[model samples]
Target: MTSVPDERFPLPEGFGPGSVWADRTGHRTLVGRTQRGVEIPIGHGEGEVNPGELLKLALIGCAGMSSDVNLSRRLGDDFAMRLWAHGTSDEADNRYLSIAEEVQLPLEGLTEKEIATVVKVFGRAVAAGCTVERSVVPGIEVTHRVLGAETDAPEEQA
Candidate 1:
């Protein structure tokens, strides 16, 4: 498969490394730390968000963040926006096939021209500039490395 090209973009400062670790509770709990030392707990149990859910959230969050910037510029600071994202996956293979996002705006007092402008700008922003959505659609490269050696082995019985 052909690899995607690397392109650099300017990002705001304060972005740094984040990490996640399996918790010791033995209940598939994970703890995450942000670059600025904020702790986030992720659990895979009742009333918790699992890894798959987090992936979907990342897409929606990026879409909202990126689109909102452009939308706000066009629709003014008083406009309100909401978004919903849904994904379909093949259960047997655990593969996602598609994702759809709906954008909603409260356009009660807006003119027809204003509504049209808002829709056009928001759609363009989400389609072209949503970083997470763009990245996932084209796929990203991943590399893995091992840092430790095995310490024990049991003898085989014939």
Candidate 2:
């Protein structure tokens, strides 16, 4: 497992900003080391999944998990959750065309007002807590570096 970048979660308490370990092949499992150095396994489905899609899935999954825990704790009942997100972008300039997420949260037992409140709260929390979602906000500084097999940092610096 490779650690996600700082742009993701602020490196949980025990995990470092970017610390992860993963099995080389078969049964994909990526263990992230929190800042506190606790090894937490990241769950994944058993199938041929694209690494690119997994990046987006991470954010969605985290938000879904967070909402589930929070709502369950507050309401004291397990609620059904359905989350779907899709985004389009231009490959050349990496410009986003559109990004949309639909969260279907069932509050069958709760009152209407309570349902509204839950949606608002959950939306805010996911907006702030979801790393991929957060990254879409403008003005975030990011740098990309390319390193070649024969590149020498010291020489390049000169």
Candidate 3:
């Protein structure tokens, strides 16, 4: 177990989002609320969004969104983009061996040199500020703990 903090860190209230998971029928589903309080169903079934899939999604989503913002600023809002992320995990050892992301952009009007420049700028911006990409590139330290009793409370009482 990780050591308990002796003093609370100074942080803004509700700094991070929250999620709720429940068993729906036989499938496990995860739901989260947006900042506007709109519920979003993330995934269902064991295989739908297992840990590895979630990891890949976080990487791709973060990079895609960040790059989209940068690209829109540079190329205006008329361009289209597609991003894909892939990774190989050694489940037996519980580690990821490699992870890669590919981005496709429709640069219909730009010259080869301009396209290259845009790619370079996007790469630099993503490396600097994409939260998920930065977290995974060097990896992050995860700490967990068990709370409450082993058995869940009744739904009516919960």
Per-residue C-alpha lDDT of model 2 across residues 1-158, encoded as one tens digit per residue: 34343553353565555445443334565544444445544555544444435554655676676566666765567666666656645588675454445555555666657765665566656655656556654433211111121222211100
Candidate 3, superposed: residue stretches over 4 Å from native: 1-47, 140-158
lDDT of 3: 0.56
User: TM-scores, in order shown?
Assistant: 0.64, 0.50, 0.61
Which stretches of candidate 1 lie above 4 Å from their native place? 1-25, 139-158
Give the Å error, residue 70, model 1. Answer: 1.9
Clashes of 3: 0
Model 1 global lDDT (CA atoms, 0 to 1)? 0.55
- Show pairs that collide, candidate 1: none
**Top TM-score hit:** 1
lDDT of 2 at 117: 60
Candidate 2 ranges beyond 4 A from true positions? 1-18, 21-46, 139-158
Return whichever of 1 and 2 wins on TM-score: 1
